[model samples]
Target: MVRYFDAELETMPWTDVLAWQAERTATFVRGLVDRSPFHTEKLAGVGVPTGVVRDLAFLEDLPFTTKAEVRESQSTRDPALPLGRHQAVPRGAIHQVLSSSGTTGQPVLYGLTATDVEMWADVIATAFWTAGVRPDDIAGHLVGLPGVAGGLPYADGFRRIGAGLAWIGGWPTERVVELMISLGVDAVLATSSFGTYLTDRCEDLVGIPAKDIGVRKMLGGGEPGLGQPEIRQKIVEGWGLDVLSEIMGLGDVLACLWAECEDGGGMHFCGQRAVAVELVDPATGEPRAWEEGVRGEAVYTTFAREATPALRYRSRDHVLVTATSCACGRTSPRIRCVGRTDDMLIYKGMNVFPSSLRDVVLQGFADDVQPSIRVWKDGSDQVRFDGPIPMDVEASDDLAPDRYREVAAAIAADVRARLQVRVAVTVVAPGSMPRTAYKTPLVHVRETDDDQ
Candidate 1:
């Protein structure tokens, strides 16, 4: 059965939704001008009108918000404005301050007001409900430390919805499995790689197959694995779970903003009332219509925020938007993240994402290759490469050492045939590559020949 946390907002008419967004956006812009000195200075000559922004086209006139800009704002150490001018609320009113995961570059700090906290909880709760998590289910959250931005919101949202949460962030795979058995956990929250890692270790740790565990639904995010058909199928078949849903969000904008419903469609925009989304051509910076198969970078603007509100915040996450109504009866748009713009590699006039390459390898090799993989370039800071990119694949335990060369050759040939990228695949023994509790790094570059 399909359940909605906020049925009125989730089921609101499409036209009404746009109207609400326009009204809220206008108010939010006005508040930014009044409360945020950084936005006030940045938007000086943009000349945005005062009233309701009835059309999204007006947004193009305003300057785009980038991660660099936010980082710069946070770096300013003026005593009067220690939290940066982008902060909208007073320091006393700030309820919580969080930092980005710093996976790409320097981590930016964000503060949330009391009201912003509630809104964040609501957005996460709606995402959880859409992912088929109910109040009666015990959710085991596998995320980073509680202080990180990615995991804390899930804990708060689960508590808000009256679901029992087992905080197992630092637990080993064996302990996690043991807890699932003892606590009767039916729902789990984890990144795709962590889920795969736990599944791979289940039998060795607990003396039972992963499928024997009682987890019914798996909520995967923090990376691109769950959305890929090959990776998702591996988790579904490996864990013996009935449903798998993907949840996506940004720390700078909102957490758990989009989530997949039970029908397994792409993640729906669950933060319709609180956030407005736009798509723009990554190369040309031109706005694109939110239509099926139209791909671009995601830009977000928050309407009802106090501590740190952003306008036209560039997410750098390339996605294809779908306007088709989902089977779950949500009128909001859905998105499938294609790749991060920073992670794109251009080789011989073709663009490739490492995640896509990993998916192709998984689909072709199945159980022969372990989920752990690393794509490497010969030189450091090299964005573009020509032929025969280097990759290291961890061979499964059951694969014989004599067959390593054959398996590596097959994987390289499959990648060439399917993804049109040439790669030199090296099959290493199991546990050669490092495993991560958070998002896995798909690309690794050796700084110098000596290091290699």
Candidate 2:
């Protein structure tokens, strides 16, 4: 039988959820207007009555909260408010603080009250349970970066679910492997790339493939690409996993919001109580309905938060709704994150994500190339490539150096035929490209000799 962390909320009727969210949002907005200076002014500027919203209908009227705005608010350095002008509670009430990875810009700090911390733990536990983490399993965590939500907050969530936890991240890979084997870790929590990286490292270090290390389950998060078919196939085969589920969240909102169930076509909405989620056109800021095949950016309102309450926060993540109903009995919609808006590239008016190109190369040319690739950019800010985009792919171990040109030609042709976009493919030697234990970036800016 399929199990849920909270069956009542997970299987609630969609119409009933709408009513619950509306009521919670109204009360949450009133508190935000009274306590948060940034939100109060923003809501008033949009002509919300008394600078407070009374219902979910006003969500569209409320201005979006952007990362730039949040960063600017904190830049003020007001002595009274360390968390920023948007902080909904006093500094003393903040029980803990976490930060973003700052991949796009400066790392933004988030505050959580004691109660908020408990709520986040529950949210993450619920997500993990949905992803098939059982209480009896010993989960070896590889997401222990300091002060990030993926670090301690996730560890707490693991324990809350009554699972055996070993916080093994931030250590050297050799040490991580040693401990996993010694402790007989059967389940793993890691970034998607790390899962693939560990597969290779295990064989190289211990002369044993990761599959032999006894790990039967893997939950990948903290980055995209885990849901891609090629990546998923690699990880599942590499680790010999019984189940592989993808979990996604943003630091600006709840840490673990969407999780894939065992029936998994995509990750179901798992943060309904803490966040009121909306799908909207990224360009037009217009709301989109939650229907299968619908594509849009995700926007979140943290209506149940205390330390910091986000009002209509715009998350630049672009996703496609894959299913409206699951055999697993989840009533919420399921989604697969397509790509981030900032990571999108335009080639001759056609939009392309680097992850998509990676998928085509790995899936179509698996024998000729390694699973790694890097897209070369003209500059750091270049998003539009006028010519065939420059990309480097590593050759497979069995592929000879002299045959690189043939493989390159085949890959370029395949990418063009599949994605309908031109890519300049250069097959490099195996291990020539960089790999990371954390998130792996697909794009690399050309470095000048002077900089080198």
For residue 162, model 1's alpha carbon misses the true position, in angstroms, by: 1.4
Instruction: Output the lDDT of residue 313, model 2.
Output: 89
Model 1 segments more than 4 A misplaced: 363-372, 394-420, 428-434, 447-452
| Model 1 lDDT at residue 139 | 94
TM-score on alpha carbons, each prediction: 0.92, 0.95
Cα lDDT of model 1 overall? 0.83
Clashing pairs in 1: none
| Model 2 Cα lDDT, one tens digit per residue, 1-452 | 44999888899976677677877787777667678888888877455434443346667877899888998888888877998998889899999999998899889999999999999999999999999998999999988685987887898889989999988987888888889889989999988888878766778877888888888999998778877777788889999999999999987888899999999899999997889998999889998989999999999999888987888888899999999999999899999998888899999998998878988998888888877789999788999989999999998889999999999999999999988999999999987777788888889899888779
TM-score of 1: 0.92
Residues 217-289 of candidate 1: C-alpha lDDT, one tens digit per residue: 9999988877777678768888899889999998899988889987875888889868988889998789988
Ten residues in sequence with the least summed lDDT for candidate 2: 46-55
lDDT of all predictions:
0.83, 0.87
Tell me, by TM-score, which candidate is best. 2
In terms of lDDT, which candidate is strongest? 2
Pairs that collide in candidate 2 are none
